[model samples]
Each structure stands twice: as C-alpha cells, then as structure tokens.
Target: MLRARRWSTRLFNLQRQGRMGTTAPIDGEEAAVVGSAAAMDPAVDWAVPQYREPVGLSRFGDRVLLHTILYHLGHPDAGAYPPDIHVFPTQISIAAQIPHAVGLAWGLRLRGEPGAVLCYFGDGATSEGDFYEAANLAGVVRAPVILLCVNNSWAISTPVRLQTAAGSIADKAAAAGIPGVRVDGNDVVAVREATAAARRRALAGEGPTLIEAVTYRMGPHTTADDPTRYVPPEELAAWAERDPIARLGTRLEQAGLWDDDRQRAAEEDADRRFDAAFDAAQATPLRDDVFIDTAYASPTPQLERQRRLLHDERSRGAG
Candidate 1:
C-alpha cells in the first residue's frame, strides 16, 4: 500500500509535467485496493480492474506496473499482456468490465477451472445498467466472481448521493439475490478478511458477493478534475484524518513490524521502480499504424486502403 501511494504520487507529478497522460490517483484508496488484491491467489484468481487500480495491483506481478507506465505513455501495446499476467487490461469505460468479468468467471466454471474473478469498480459504476445485468447473471449462473465496489464517495465530479438512492452501495446487491458486505475501506485488514471470505464462498459454489468498500478519494477524480470546486474543505480534512497508509503504518509500528528505516527503504524502492518503468516506456520505439495492424487478422479491402492512405500521408509529411 505504501509503495502504491508513492507510485501514484510520482505518476500524478508525471502527468502535471506532461510526461504522462491524465491518471486517477489512488491516494487514499490504497488500502482498499491492495488489501483485496492481497487476499487473492494470483495464480488462480483473475483481477479485472478499472483505471484507478494498476498501481495497487503489484500483488499480481511487476508487469502490471510496467504496463501501467506504458499505458500512461499512450503505447498501443498497453493493453497487451503476456499469458502469465492474470490481470485484465484497465478498462476506462464505466461498468463495462463487470459483464466481462462475469463471462470470464462463468467460462472458468464451465471449463471446470478452479478460480474466481475479482472485479473492481467504483460506486459510480453501480449506476450503470451493466452492473445490474452482470450481477443478476452471476447470481443466476452461480458464477465465481466477486464484485468489489470501491465507494470512494464520488464519481468524477458527481457525489454518491447524486448517483444512487440506496442507503449504501452494498444494499443494491440484494436485487441480485447475493450476499452484500460493507467493510471499512480504510482498514486494510478488514478489507483483506472480507475479500478472503468472499473468495471462499465463491470457490464453494456460492453466487457472487458484492463488497462495498466505503472510503474517500483524497485527490481529484482525475488529473483533469479540480475537487476543490465541489469537495468541501472540512469534509476533505475529516477524511484525511482517516488516511489508510498512516492508519496501517501506525498499527504496524505499534506491533514492531515497521520502522522508519523500512518505510524509507520501501519509498526508495518505489521511486527506483517508477523511474525504471518510465524510462523503458519512453525508450520504446513507436509503432506506426499499430491500431490498423491489430484491428483485424485479415484486413478488408477498405481498411487496407485506409491503412495505405495513412502511411502515404505520413510518408509525404516526412519527405
């Protein structure tokens, strides 16, 4: 979680400097992401994440971070992962990944594979129709999937109250006829335990579980957003008091498991990794017309003509 926080900070700065694209900061939501990820067996379980989660997905593999850097660099291959990487590409479309996750989980079950799919989305996604359809199907099919709703209180600029009328995000799960759990998102241990319990239930042939991780987003919805406009100063301050990293660090220190030296080492390691990944991303050669090449296995006549036209235009411009 500390590493994720540090990396997110650097990524945010990179965006400000115009070296990277706009990114959603995982500032206060680190524990919710890292804790649930910690509960999964990377070899068996699959992680389907929305855009905000790559930094916190290190539990899956180092490649997740590497690909994240590439993604921020706007590489076409950013979505391409080698077979061993168990995470799906970060989906920018709201709630679209939910149904995909359900499909993946159902496919696994049909094939007699052993694993559950962990789908992470924000509370805002629950407002979309895709969430309902996916949840309903998962329940009916008894698909091994966990719907983790990271309710960070806001969806871009829209507050949770404006997004839903439900008392809590977890309450929506009842319509799907599945278990709903609300956990303290700031508490890493609680999130981990809840996720582990959900995974066990799924593995035991129970239906999907909806976990509402109630927390607050400490930063803007994205680099393009200005939270100061809508978020009240006092409310922000109140949530700041519950910062997940500090809360976890305090507990670990009290248990004698953490020290300043260890903290510094982790920060240093995170910096080194961010630097290395960014450097590699920048060093990668640009692949011209990569979208055209990858769009179809066999390009139709019109697409082939379009590709040629694009190449010709580039060639003429170069000359």
Candidate 2:
C-alpha cells in the first residue's frame, strides 16, 4: 500500500508541476482502492473508475499512457485493449458514470459473461439523482456490478456531515433494494474480503451491492483546494493516526510479511518507476493540430474550416 501511495503522490506532484491536469489525490485512500482491486481477477473484472481510482487502474496494468490519454481527455476507446483496463476520464460532473457502468454490466449479462463491474465513487455522489437511478436499475435487473463508495468524508469543500443527514452512504443502497455493507476502509485485508464476496454474489446474479469503505481524505481534495480551511487540525491529525498505508505496513510487519528494509526498497522502486513514467510522458509527442482536429468520425463545416486553417498555417510555417 505504501508503494501505491508513492505512485499517487508522484502523480499528484506531476499535476502540480503542470505536467498533468488537476488530479484527485488518493494518498490516504490507497488501502480501499488497492485492496478492492486485489480481490478480483483483472483478466475478467471491469473497473469503471472515477478520477481518484488510480490504485485500481494501476493494479490492472494501466500505464503512463493511460494517464497521458486521460490528461488530454483523449479518446481511450481506441486504446482500451485486453489487460490495459478501463477508466472513465475523470468526471467533473459527479455520479455521471453510474448509469454507464450499469449499461456495461447489462450488456455483459446479456452475453452471459461471468464477470463483475466495480464502480467507484465518493460519498458526495450519493446525493446525485443519477446515483439512485442507476442503483435502482442495477437492483431491478440484478446487474453484475458492485457499487463501491470510498466515503472519504469530504467533497471538495463540503464536509460529509453536510452532504447527507443519513448515518452512512451505504444505507442509501437499502432504498434501492440492494444490500449494503460498511467496512474499515483502512483495513486492506478486510476490504479485499468484502469486495471478493460482493463480486461472487454479483456474478451469481444476486444483484448489486453497495460497499461503503469508510475512510478519510488525508490530502486536500485537489491541488487547488485548501483542506485546512474547513477541516480542523485535530481531525486531520486523528485521521493521520489511522493512515491506510501506515496501518498496512504495521500489520505486515507484525505478520513478518515485510520489514523496514523492504518498505524502503519498495518506496525507492516506486519513486524510480514514477520518475521514468513522468519522463516518458513528458517526452511523448503531442499532436500538433489536436486543437483543430475533429475527434468525431464526420467533421462539421466549422471543424473542416479550422482544419484547413491549421493546414495552411503549417504549410506557411506559421503554426
């Protein structure tokens, strides 16, 4: 999990350096993401990730190229192939991908596929109309999907207390006629167990289940947001005590599964990998006329004119 944090932190730093766009930090949420991802078979399971789900995407072999495509908001469909995994371009509009995941599961079910779709979202997304709508459809049709909510206790500037009056986001799933379970999001082992069970049930056509991994967002919502304004220092310190990566490392140490030397080596390895990936991403050639390129199959008259202008500029060495 510390390795996961290393990757997330490196990516977060890259975003700050203008090498990438705004990114949702998963520094504290690594356990929830990695544990859940580890429970499934990457060869079969599908992950419909939000912007913050790099842990899952990385576990599924998503590489720097995936991040490159995501940063540019480039079309991933053309590049999404076996073992590369799937991640929806970070959704600024909350809860938008819920229905899309449902549709994917519905199609998979129609084809009699034995796999589950894991949809990641935040606690704030529960308030959106689409969240309930999609959950209802999944429940009614018994779609092979798991609704996983990483309740990090904040939505940008909004605290979770103000986001909902309910005790937990998992409870909302009850209204949609689905089972809901709350687990220790910081406990990677527990999360893996719960998600594995949920996946089994989903593949059996039992119905959609909502698993709320109760955790906290240790970092600011983004590089642009200041968490100190709304979050008290004491609360932050308390959450820090329960830091997911630290907890996992401690547990592994106790079990003799890891040691300080191993931890340091892992951190160093992750840092080197991230540095190489960043360099590669920076060296990648950007499409010269992407701004004027028509992404659609059929270009409109306006797009055609823009393309011609770009071509003329290139020919005249004015680009």
What CA root-mean-square deviation does each model show from the true structure?
Answer: 1.2, 2.7
Pairs with steric clashes in candidate 1: none
lDDT of 1 by residue, 68-87 (tens): 98887789878787788899
Please, what are the lDDT tens digits per residue for candidate 2 over residues 1-319?
A: 6666777676677777776666667878888988998887866777787777754467666473346334533433323334545444455578998988888888889998777888888999999998999999999999988899999989987889999989889889888999999999988999999999999999888978999999999998976788888988998899999998888778778999999789789889878776776665566566666545437667778888988987888889963
Q: After best superposition, candidate 1 residue 51: deviation in angstroms? A: 0.6
lDDT scores of the candidates, listed in order: 0.93, 0.79
TM-score of each: 0.97, 0.90
Residue 203 C-alpha lDDT in model 2: 86
